[model samples]
Target: MMNTDDVVIHVKEMLERASRPITEECCIYRVPLLIRQLNQEAYTPKIVSIGPYHHNSLHLQNMERHKVMYLKSFLERTNTSMESWIHYIASKEPLIRHCYSDALQFTPNKLVEIISVDSGFILELFWTSNYGTDDMYLSLPWFATTIFCDLLLLENQLPFFVLHDLFCLSVANFGNNDIPPFILLTFGYFQSLNESICLLIQCHHDLRSLTNFYLCGENKTTHGEEPMATNSSVNKWSEAGIKFAITKAMNTGKDVDILVRDGIMENLLGDSDAAAERTKRLCRNIVLSDFQF
Candidate 1:
């Protein structure tokens, strides 16, 4: 639409505004629409809208009020001021924005407001779930389950650095409450979602590594050693004097009732033929990756 000189000027201006290369700071992202469209419900948050992606969805507005309530509690309990937090977060705007994959449209003040409130909510949630009394917003059974599930969706995320910074800032005020380190608290909060949580101690920053450990039940590679993959069935592994640390287990009633916990099969009924029949069908119609799905 322009002449050569105009084109040159546009290119130069664009180069001047180019973003820094992607680094560790970049983690949050929007799911590709191709992937999301296959099962939009699976990717969408049900209760809480975290970060900027689903920030102001009308359906998620209910949680917005709760976020403010949490912020208020966080400020009151620590005797800190939101004004100061907002100002501090404003200074880190560029670093925070870089963490997200998209170019957010919110102005500086709006972005600061969102970051300060969301970060405070998470910090308060971690603290209260660990140290506070039995009575709190999280005590609501349905709300607790739904909100936590929402928090784990890939799109509903904030950079870990922001949460870590807030934790470091306000942790000293927890005052001998016996709160463990921020990472430990975070681990505890999400432990229910991952049975092989012990591996998280070493692989917390690497989702792929953590997922590998989660599915394989052990590290595929150890330091000073070569990469290796091994497979052993649950019954065989258990028979070999190996015990697994599982999140939960259950004994099903008689008549070949299968036991499941959090979508995972925990135990089969003691009837050998019935259990065998069920186990035989476990892989039916499943699209196995070269590795197990």
Candidate 2:
């Protein structure tokens, strides 16, 4: 029997060879089979054939509503548990479509649609159970897929989605070292997109601590601290933070558009355009000199 290292190496190698938009058959179905082959301690294969097309066909047929005679017999024969069934179904390539569809089945309209609820979709799509912990393994993939969908479906109002995507990336990197390499690369790709949502949010308003934001979201903003956007000290802190983030983007060869308007930047610098200009020019000179500032 192969060891844990062998299993890991084999999985990594398979992942490397696979192209973008990975297949459910290969990743979800085949990968598990491969792992089970390598290590018996891994999960058991309860059921198979959870591909997108098959699931979509089931949805179109309205099998859930009618509770068909054959379908009952099929379930009884399979003896599949609900949780395991859902997990297996979600491991497929067309998993996102199924997830979104299943989510909408109990919704008001019983139809799949996005972007009609203003920016409320961001909150709904990426809900957190608690404020303190940052275990986002489940949230990340959904966030990424939603952002990609928004880019396609909400082209006109793409800024909000992009900003939300950036927020996810920032929060993911904020307090975690267990992020997968593909997730990191995906974060980098979204950041590089010229009109970044994160920059817009950072520039338009300052970023409060995650805990503080959570509190504010819950209407428990009783901790007397100045607003991120208007407070002078907060503005300065935010500017420095934005500069650092932008600098990091530049170093990584990502295209970054500064979101702070010139007038606002000047206002933040105590109505001193000269000082702000001087600082920017100095930064430019430092860049030209090839010296790390």
On TM-score, the leading prediction is 1
User: Per-residue error at 193 for model 1, in Å?
Assistant: 2.8
Query: What lDDT would candidate 2 get against the real structure?
Result: 0.29
Please provide, for model 2 over 10-129, each residue's C-alpha lDDT reduced to its tens digit, 9 standing for 90 to 100.
999999986544433221112234434443322221111112212234322432222233233323333433344233323431433322221223332212112112212222223321
Candidate 1 backbone collisions, by pair: none
Q: Candidate 1's residue-wise lDDT over 12-127, tens digit each?
A: 99999997666566777777776665556767899887788899788989888888888888888877777768777888898788777788888878888888888888878877
Q: Which ranges in model 2 have alpha carbons more than 4 Å from their true place?
A: 1-87, 90-103, 106-180, 193-293
What are the root-mean-square deviations of the candidates from the true structure over C-alphas?
A: 7.1, 22.2
lDDT of 1 at 143: 85
lDDT for each candidate structure = 0.64, 0.29
